[model samples]
Target: MKPHLTLPIAIATALALAACSAAEPPAPAEPPVATETPATPMPADPMPATPANPSVGGAAMDAGKDIVTNASAAPNLSTLVAAVKAADLVATLQGAGPFTVFAPTDDAFAKLPAGTVDGLLKPEMKADLAGLLTYHVVAGNVDAAALTQQIEVGGGSATLTTVQGAILTAMSDGAGGITLTDGKGGTAKVTTADVRQSNGVVHVIDSVLMPK
Candidate 1:
């Protein structure tokens, strides 16, 4: 009986050992699956800049505005503006004309004989004032670069026909400046150049240009 009992106990022990060996050893703790961190993103490129408009007569000259509007805003161009209004040329200048205007400042008008401006502003002198004012204007948009090119092509001097039916001579003043000779043989120097307007361009002069 004792031998039989010993054989049964041995069999039971062997069965328990086989069951333990077959069981998975807790999957080896899964090796702690390494969590990869996400990568950072990069930035984009910048844009190009635009050019700014130039200033005039202690005021900002807007390239979006017309010649009459711009001239009316300038502190030094008040006399010229008044003359334009008196001469009934506001409509003409404000029209769609890519004109080139040789604008004279208040100081330039002051250089004339005393009471000359006042006399011209009178109602009777309207036609005369209009003629004088129109003498400073050309048909198309002639900027400084175009004028310079014309000067170079015309043997150092260029003849510009004004809207007033008169010719004005443009030449280099031998000192890196432009000098304009009117129909009356008087000379005016360009103090400010390339003052761009929506309907035209302006070159401010030290003296007023006159017609015959």
Candidate 2:
């Protein structure tokens, strides 16, 4: 395999070139603006705090039940339990978000070789930690049924607008499951679904979703 193949997919997703300029060969012209045309469904732009839920919860829900407590109750998520709290996202998790969180269990995070998690938790690394945490949350109330159905139809993909204001592309696994392609194109599989809460739903994944 090529050495570039080893680079994280998140990086690639983040840096994808929007376009490349070509040499100028003609005079610049103003683009056309259409006059009164029927509007059509514009696929979707990730989904930034939809109309149904326009609230932001940066810190008001710390005392409420959150991903940490929920993941903790499940014996298999002990590690994920630690990471969520460490990232200072427990409160955000409990906020009245209607957030669609793609949660990874403890064992899923263990897939990383070593030292990565430790380095990310350093005090100076708060920004990086926050980005990683928010990448797991889609800004609206997206249920599994909605996701799978989106794929089954020819949608082929749906973009999720992360709390960090980043986009994560999700595609179907073709086996009644969904796979999330991180900003860098890294994929995380949904292992469990519909872990409901007052604010939103949680879907357990077998791998951590990283941003590029």
RMSD score of candidate 1 (Å): 6.0
Which digits, one per residue and each the tens of the lDDT, describe model 1 over residues 1-212?
Answer: 46769988999999999999888475655568788889776666666664455676888888888989999989999999999999999998888898999999999999999999999999999999999999999999998789988999999999999999899999998887899999889999999888888898899999999887
User: lDDT of model 2 at residue 17?
Assistant: 40
User: Over the full model, what C-alpha lDDT does candidate 1 score relative to the true structure?
Assistant: 0.91
Q: Write the per-residue lDDT of candidate 2 for residues 52-89, one digit (tens) a residue.
A: 31111212222235555555566666666566667788
Pairs clashing in candidate 1?
A: none
Q: lDDT values of the candidates?
A: 0.91, 0.72
In the predicted model 2, the residue pairs found to clash are 9-184, 10-184, 10-212, 13-183, 13-184
For residue 171, give model 1's deviation from the true position in Å: 0.5
TM-score to native of every candidate shown: 0.76, 0.65
What's model 2's TM-score? 0.65
Query: TM-score of the candidate numbered 1?
Result: 0.76
